[model samples]
Target: MNLDEKMLLLATCFLFLPYQIASVGIACILVQAFCRHKLVDAIKNQTGAIFLYSFIGLEFIVTILHSNWTGLGNTWLFVLVGLYGAYYRKSITKNTFEKMCDLVIILSIFAAIYGLYQFNQISIANGRTFLEFHIFNSPKRRITSTFMNANIYAMVIDFVCVMCMYRFVKNDNILCKIGYVIVALFNFFVLYLTGSRTALLPFVLIFPIFLYCVRWKKLFITSIVLELCVCGLVFLKPSLIPRMSDMSTFASRIKIWKTAFICISMYPLFGWGPQTYKKFYP
Candidate 1:
């Protein structure tokens, strides 16, 4: 692979790492872009480049108008990542993309293992059983793996679980299929340990559609049985699924969303400025 391709792979691998470490991936992309001197061509060749550039421009305008410089750095980083994606898309081969996906799956599995280790350590330190750790301490005692937050870790696991499910359905090799299923389940359990209600929402919404698309009768039946069992467990002990017993989280989310909509309505065209939502959210 060329330098750009190598940088793209590096970036993908760094995605699940802690933010401090992940900054290296962003630097790699920027350095590669500068070395290649093809950034202008990359912008020109990318589809919807105009819209992205316009959005960035508008963000800058809004930032200036509101004097909210705190978010401009993030805005610039977002632009850089988008530009790098366009360049990577134009240059990447099918085989390289497949390799990148495999790397992502491998990294995700490692992350899940680490998260499980974190869970075990925390449970031991607190003199609690695994179930107790999740039921009573979760959303507070949740594992973050390499990321800074449990919710972010859960989101990443959610993506990997979907990819593993897809691979399990499509792969012809029985051994490979079994491996995918094992990895998927492993990551999914770790996801549950995260106590992220939002992350679970997508999985609940997607599983039926996925089963329908694959049309595997045995698998579909198995999933339904598993779902019913899980529902029964939750019904008996709502705390078994972390945060499910708590209504306050739902109420807080609704309030936040309502406030966010109100803020957006106040500045319908451009946002009040990136990262300014907290300041104006009340």
Candidate 2:
């Protein structure tokens, strides 16, 4: 890729703004799509098509609601997904996909190891402390992985863990399976370090669904029942409850949604152009 694209890829791990990485991803996808036109048509029939379209559509809605579309380049995530769908046309290059999976695994492992080191007071270069592990103003560290914040770091690791586990289950190699075990342990450590209750819930709930996809129908059904039980218990037991009801934390999100709703109401047709949510929200 060019220098700009390289910068975008580097920016992906920055965490304060993932849209930068998304932009690069979109660019890659678009480049691939142009090279292979058939993939665009194929994308239309995929299972997550509705959700994907809706997600993109909602961004426009938010822009219209807020009457601002500045810095909207970040929404390239959808474009990248589209590109990815098309680019993997040649199934013969299974190694490429495995490599991508491996990259994610490596990144997560690096994050975990770095986090551990940071916690242990292992000095980094040039007076740059690992900010992810810092708790509040006191420096009581929390493992933020490499994303600069523990929760986001954990989420990234969780994502990688899922992908790696899926690949491990499908692949026949013993070494690959062992590598996945390492990835899983590293991911689990990072997840625990974050102490994000909300993030952990989805991980537990999605396990059975993921297994079900791999032909474990009975396990899938059991997971559904177990998920319900988990939810019910969460509602009933005050002490065991997850932090899903923190109004102050989610309040800004509510405002953002409300603002988007009002903007969309005002300009339901054509929407407020694009990337206007931040401008309007502010």
Candidate 3:
């Protein structure tokens, strides 16, 4: 890759502005596509991308026809999905995918460190720290880290944790194993502080999967026992024990999904033009 492309790839490491950086890179890819014949190849060879972007293109046209002013500006971004396929073809190499995975890990590490910094930045008030841990009940507040919201932070937090866990379980090198274990623990701590109830499910499933993949029955059973002990501590919180009975927390998600389904039913061929759900959703 040239210096320009290298810089664009480097921009992907910023966890706080992932979408913005990716959009910039997509712009570069589009510039390159105009100068060469690769754009034709992306359409002809990448049928899946073509299908997805065709719908996205339809949505943009529909939004203009409907005069939906809310998400009209952002509607152009849907084309980037297909553009990325073109970008991948521009730099065909096995290491491209591996390097992308590495960037995700690096981005996650930066996010975790920022979260810890945010945790310390909170000043104690009335002799009580704001960073409270409630394993079962909903937390009073959540740490957003560098993201716009804690839930957005939660979505990307698992990337490094799962990566480290796989390395810790499969690596033959003892030093690498130790390093990955430490990173994995730090990821779990950050995941907890995010206070995203749904995000916790990854660790619940990841640990068991890693142990099972290692192919040691005794190790798997021992890990389960240790996890159960941790769960017992959380169970002491009464609300945590009956979280399923408390359905109030999922109200926003249910409403969002219902709105999306209604919109899709109304316009089955295309979505409500990218982020237009915010405008029309009840």
Winning model by TM-score = 1
What are the C-alpha RMSDs, in order, of all predicted structures? 2.8, 7.7, 4.1
Q: Go through the candidates in order and give each one's C-alpha lDDT.
A: 0.78, 0.60, 0.66
Which should have the higher lDDT, number 1 or number 2? 1
Tens-digit per-residue lDDT, 77-185, candidate 1: 6676677777777768876776677678888888988988888888887787766654333455679999888888988888888888777766689998888888888
Q: State the local distance difference test value for candidate 2.
A: 0.60
Tens digit of per-residue lDDT, candidate 3, span 21-73: 75776767667765676566656677577578777777778788877765566
The superposed Cα distance between candidate 3 and the true structure at residue 72, in angstroms, equals: 3.2
TM-score of every candidate relative to the true structure: 0.85, 0.56, 0.76
Best candidate, lDDT-wise? 1
For model 2, what is the alpha-carbon lDDT of residue 241? 37
